[model samples]
Every structure is written in structure tokens, then in C-alpha cells.
Target: MESLAPALGLGWDRQLGPSLPLSKVTVSAPEKDKWRRIEPTINTIWPIVEKADARAREFVARRRAATRAAA
Candidate 1:
């Protein structure tokens, strides 16, 4: 899991800037069973998540450009 941190754009410390910590948690049996059902749904929708992230970044860039032009 630690190895996948970099792939997920996670950092070990806040030296570069602000960082959000992602840690593993111990789940109860019921919680684990629930995740077992939900995990596949998340996996299926991951592509949509990526697409939305790209769109958000593009929107931010366009907004910044418009702000600069206005200024």
C-alpha cells in the first residue's frame, strides 16, 4: 500500500506544500463486507473520476487565463 502512494500522488511529508495524510484503517467484519460490495462500484467508476478530474483542471486553467486577461 505504501508503494502505491506515489502512484496516487501522495506524499510522505508536507515539505513540498500542504499534504493530506492517507492511512490504513482496521475495519470490522460488517464494514469489510460492505466495502466488498462497494469496492467494485468504485472500480467501475474510476474512469469517470479521472475524466472529471481532468475537466476540473481544464476549467481551473481556463478560469485563471480569463482572470489574467480581465486584469
Candidate 2:
């Protein structure tokens, strides 16, 4: 059967169109206020974030090397 996901706007496969205009953006007080506490937690996690980024870079380097070898 043909997919209903695109018709229902549920899946990512469809390149439907540009997102709703910036003017249409929804502002949520709950979401905005929740991040106030998270800001300090993110600062505390800075070292962890740096390590994760370095690991990702190493993974990408390994993948590129393997791709070059296969080619």
C-alpha cells in the first residue's frame, strides 16, 4: 500500500516545504524557564562535552581512512 505518513505529515521522508514562518514560531514559558536551571548543568558538563566531541572526531577520521582504503 502507498504510504499515509507523508499525507498525515508524520514521517521525515517527505520534503514537504519550508517550515512555517518565523513569525509563526510558538513561544512557551515552560520550555524557556526550564532551561534556566539547565544552563549551569551544561557548564558543569563542559569537560564531558569536549571529550565527546573529540571522540566523534576520532570516529570520523577512522571512517574516512576505511573509506579511502575500500576505494
Candidate 3:
């Protein structure tokens, strides 16, 4: 998932966003459940989660920064 950060950023930035030609697909419940179990065992998922969290925090910070800039 950490590998997905760049693509995710592109989507968020509207640079590589979802559109008719680039529609996103979701995983099935069973696959999702399997991934849930694999996350903790793999240890690789932790960085991904941290990166996502940091991204989210950065997004919030950006929003707040915009408000501050406006003020």
C-alpha cells in the first residue's frame, strides 16, 4: 500500500484521478478479509498505514493552512 502512495497522491491532486477511462475497482469481501489478516503478519503494511495517516494529516494541515492563508 505504501507503494500506492504516489498514485494516491496523484488521484488526490487530480493529476491521475478517476474518470470514465480510469475507474477504480474494489476488492471482494473475502479478499478484503484475507488482506486484513495478512496486514499484521506481513509487517510491510505498517508503513503503508503510517503513510496513509500522514497523508491524511497533511491534507488536514493543508486545509487549515488555506484557512489561515485566507484569514
Give each model a TM-score: 0.36, 0.37, 0.34
Name the top TM-score candidate: 2
The sequence of per-residue lDDT tens digits that candidate 3 reaches over residues 1-71 is 22244323432333543433523564443334576566566686567588888988788677656656776
Query: Candidate 1 on 1-71: residue-level lDDT in tens?
Result: 34333433455552443554444573543334676667889889888798898987786676656656776
Q: In candidate 3, list every pair of residues with a backbone clash.
A: none
Instruction: Give the backbone clash total of model 1.
Output: 0
Ranking the candidates on TM-score from highest down gives: 2, 1, 3
Q: Give the Cα error of residue 15 in candidate 1, in Å.
A: 22
Model 2 residue 55 CA deviation in Å: 0.8
Please give the CA lDDT of all the candidate structures.
Answer: 0.61, 0.60, 0.56
Please give the clash total of every predicted structure, in order. 0, 0, 0
Q: What's model 3's overall lDDT?
A: 0.56
